[model samples]
Target: MTGPDSHRLVRSPGVGSVVIGPAADGSRRPDLVVAADDAIDWTVFDGLTVPAGYPWPRIIVYEGDDTGFFDWARRRPIGTFEWRPSSAHVVDATGANINRLWIGLRTAPLHLTVPSMPHGVLTVNGDLSLLTAVLADGGACPAVDFQPDTLPAADAVPLRLPDLPAFAGAQHVTVTVRPLRQAFDCASLLQFPDTRHLSLGGQLVNVAALAQLRHLRGLQLRFCPDLTGLPALDSWPELTHLIAFNVEEATGKRLRGELRRPGREWERSGVSQLRRPEWFATEYGLPFSGWPAAKAKKATTAYRTAQRAIATATGPDGVEAAIRAFVAVVNAMPGIETTEREDAGDAVAQLAEDTPFGDLTEDAQDWFDDARDF
Candidate 1:
C-alpha cells in the first residue's frame, strides 16, 4: 500500500505483513497494518500521516513491546485499545479507555499511569504494587485482577490501595495469592459498595465483614482453608451465587446449614448452595462401617469372628476371644482412637452368658461413632 509520502509500505510475506494506505473510497485514510512477530520493526509505520476528518480505528489490540506504540497512538485521536503486553517498560494510558490490560511479564514489575479510563479491566501477573500506585494516583479503573509475584511479608502488612476511593464505582475485583497466604483483609475493600462481583483466594480467614456490602451479587472464596467465618446471607439480599472451596470444616458446615435453612427468605431466593463434605470419612479415610466390599473385607471378618465368639463360646476364654476380635475390628478402621478401642473392649467383656449377640454388636457399633467424635 502507498503512504502519504508516495513510498510503498513494506509487506512481509509471513505473519508480520504490513498494510497501510487509502481505502477504496480514495480518501487519504492511513492504516498502519503490522502483524505480530518476534522481530517486529515498529518503525515501519513511522512518518505515516492520516487525512483530517478520517475516522480512526477505535480498538487497537497490541501484543508486543510498548516501545513507541503508546506515544504513536496518543498522538492520534483514538477512543480505546486492548493492550496485551508480553514485555513493556511503561504504559501511558492517559486519555484512552484500556478495556483490557493483560501484563504477561512473569517476573518484572509493570509500571503504568492511568490518568483516565472510567471503564477498564487490568490483569497483572507481576508485582501488584504497580496497580496500587496507579490507583493511588487517581486512576479511575473499574476492574482489576491482581496476582502478586511473591507472598506478602509475614508482618501482616496486607496489600492496600490507599486511593481505592477513587474507583468507588468498580463493579468487579479478583485477587489470587499463591501458597495460600493472607495478604490482605476485607476492610480494605469497604469503600467499594457498588462492587457486584468479588473473588478472593488464599488464606482469608474471616469474611463476615463483607456482609456490609448489600449490593454484592456473586461471591467466590477459594483455597482459603483458614477461613472459619462468613457474613449472614440475609444481609446481601441481592446475592444469588456463593461458592467456597477448601474452607474450614466448621465454616463449611455453618454455611451449608445457613444457605439451606428452611423458611428463610434468602434461601427461597434461589441462591445456589455448594459445600465440600465435612465428614471425617471423606476428608481423612474410609468410613469405619459401610465401606465398600473390596475395602471392608478385613473389618467384616473381625466383626463376624467377634459375633461368633460372643454367641457360641462360654466363660472367660470366650470373653477374651470376643474382646480381642472386637479390638481387631476397631484397629482395622481408620482414625480410631485409643479410648474407643478400650471402650469397645470393656463393652465386649460385659457380654453375659445369656446376652444376645445382636445387643453386643450394637454396643460395639456405638463405640465406632465415639472414635470419630461424630
Candidate 2:
C-alpha cells in the first residue's frame, strides 16, 4: 500500500512495470502492476498486451480517471471488467466481448476520444451524443457530459436522437439523457433486429412508442417526460421487468394499460429543477393593454425579481425573504384583481416548489396567505 500521491503511472505498450512477487504455485512470479495518479488518454491501452506464460496486467488506479475505458474493453476478445475503482483489476490483454456493454467512467482531468466498437448491449452513464453519430465514425461519445440545464430553451427545438446501425443488432441497449431534453424516434427502434432488453432514460419519448420491438423482455424508462407519438404497446410474449420513473400519473396509467400491468408499476419525483431563474419566468395573461398592461408588467417584474432572488438565495432565510418580497409586491399592485393575484401566486409557488423551500418549511401556503393581502 502506498500514499495516494506517491503512486507512479503506467502508460505503455508492454508491461510498464513488473514486481517479482509470490506465485500461487509457491514460486516467485513477476506481477505486472500498472498504476497511475494522473489522467491518461483512452488510447493508452491501444497497443498494450501481455506476454505469453505471464498473467494479464493488473491495473491499480490510485488517482487516474478512465473515460470510455469500459466499453472499449467490452467490444470483442472478451475480458471481464469489474467496473469498481481504486482497486487492482486484472485486465485481459484482448479485452471483453459480452452481451451487455456498460459505458461509464470516473472523472477525467483530460478526456480522450472514445474508440467506436462494431456493436452489442449498450448502457450509457455520461454523454451519449455518440448514439447520434454514425457507427463507423471511429470515435463516438460526447466529449463532455453537457451540463444538465434547468432553464427551458423555450424557442429552441430539442435535438432528436437519430437511429443508427450501432443499435440494430444490440440485444440490450440502454441510453438515458434526461436533463438535456433530447428526443428519439421510437418507430425506428423497431428496425433493431434482435433487441430484447431496452432502457431509455433522461430523454423525451412518446409514451405509446416502443411497441413494435417484439423480442423485448425488459424495459426500464427513466425521466422521460414527453408523451407525443402514436400510442401502441406491442405485446411481446417474453415481456417481463417493465418499469419507469418520473412519469405523470395519467401517463403511468396509460403505460400500465399498454404494458398490460395490474397495479401501478411506475413512480414519479414530480420535480423539474432548473438552474436558471429565467426558466421560471413567463409572461402572465393574454396580450396586456392599457391599465392591465402596466399592472402585468409590475407583477411579472416582481415575479422575475423574486425568481432571481430565490435562485441566488443562500439559505432558508434568504428564500423566505425572496418569497416575502414577492408577496409584498403582489399585495401592493395597484387595484390587483383576483385573476392577477392567483396567477402571480401560482408562479411564485411554482418557483418555490422547484427549490427545496417546501422541504425547508412547514405549511408554505399558510405562510403565503398570511403575507399576501389579495
Candidate 3:
C-alpha cells in the first residue's frame, strides 16, 4: 500500500513542479498537491482508484486552476476533506457533481456550501441555471445554507416545488441574497410544507408569500431592507419562534402587537425572538451613542404600566389592553434597536401566555443573556 512517504511521479507536459507532501497538521496522511498547468487535466481521477489501507488524502493544496481541481475532487469519496484553493479564481464544482457527492456522503452531514469566488462578497456570477439543476437532482442533505453569488437575471425562472425535493426533509434552510437591485420571489417554497425552519435574508421586497409555509416552527428574516410589510400569520399555525432584523419601524410595531395578543393559538405557543439592532451596530462599530436617561425612564415607566395592566385585566379584553400597553412601552424606548424591541416583545408575550419569565431552553436562554450584555 502507498503510504504518506510514498512518492509517485505524475508527468504531464509543462507540469514538473507538482509536489505532494505530508498533511499540514503533521499527520501521517499525505496531502494531494496540484498546481495550475494547462497541460494537466484534473479529470485524471477517472481512471484511478484509492489504494487499500491508504485512505484518500484529507487535505488538498491546489495552487492553481480551481475549476479543473474541483472537477477532479468531485468524483472522489466525500470523507473528511479540506481544500485550500490558493488561486484567485476558485470555482466550486458542487453545482456539477452535487447529486453524486451528496448521495454518497449523506451519512455525514456536510457544511453548507457557500459560493467561493475571487471576491469575498457572497455573489454568484456564473450560470444560475446550475442551481436549479442541482436542487432538482433530489439528493437529501440535512441543512443547506445557500447564497447565490447574484440575483437571478430578468429571464431567469423561479425555483419550483419539483426542483427542491432535496430540501423536502431538511431541518433548516437559510438563504441570503442581500442588496438585490431587482425583485426575486421565492414563493415556490410553499410546496415544501415539511420544512420546519426557514431563514430568509436579503433585500427581497416582500416575503408575505412565505406565510404559506404553514409547517414552519421557526422563521428568521434578516437584513431585508425593502421588506416594509408582512401578511397575516393566521396561516402559520405551527410557527412558534419569530425573529426579524433590520425591518421597518411600522412593521416591527405591528408584529409586536400580533405576538402579544392572547386569543391567537400561535401567539400563545411562543414568543418573538428579537435581537437589538443597536447590539449589531455596536458590535460592527457603527456610529451610535448610548440611550438618554430621560428616554430610559420613559421606557421603564411604560413597562411598569403594562405589567400592572396585565395583573388587573382578565379574559380577551385584558389581553388586548396588555398588548397595547407593551407596544406603547416598546415604542417609547427609542434607544432599544429593532431586535431588542422584538426580544422585549417576546418577554411580554410570554407573560401574557402565563408562562414563566426566561422559560427558554438552556441554549436559547444563554443567547438571550448574552444579547442583553451585547
lDDT leader = 1
Looking at model 1, report the run of 10 residues with the lowest lDDT sum: 21-30
Clash pairs, model 1 backbone: none
* lDDT of every model, 2 decimals: 0.51, 0.46, 0.45
Worst 10 residues of 2 by lDDT: 141-150
lDDT of 2 by residue, 63-137 (tens): 222324545555423232323233223332223343233333333221222234335333333333333323334
What is the TM-score ranking, best to worst? 1, 3, 2
Better of 1 and 3 by TM-score: 1
The best candidate by TM-score is: 1
User: If both were scored by TM-score, which would come out higher, candidate 2 or candidate 3?
Assistant: 3
The sequence of per-residue lDDT tens digits that candidate 3 reaches over residues 305-332 is 7557656765445645555655555554
| Candidate 3: pairs in clash | 123-149, 124-149, 124-150, 275-339, 276-339, 276-340
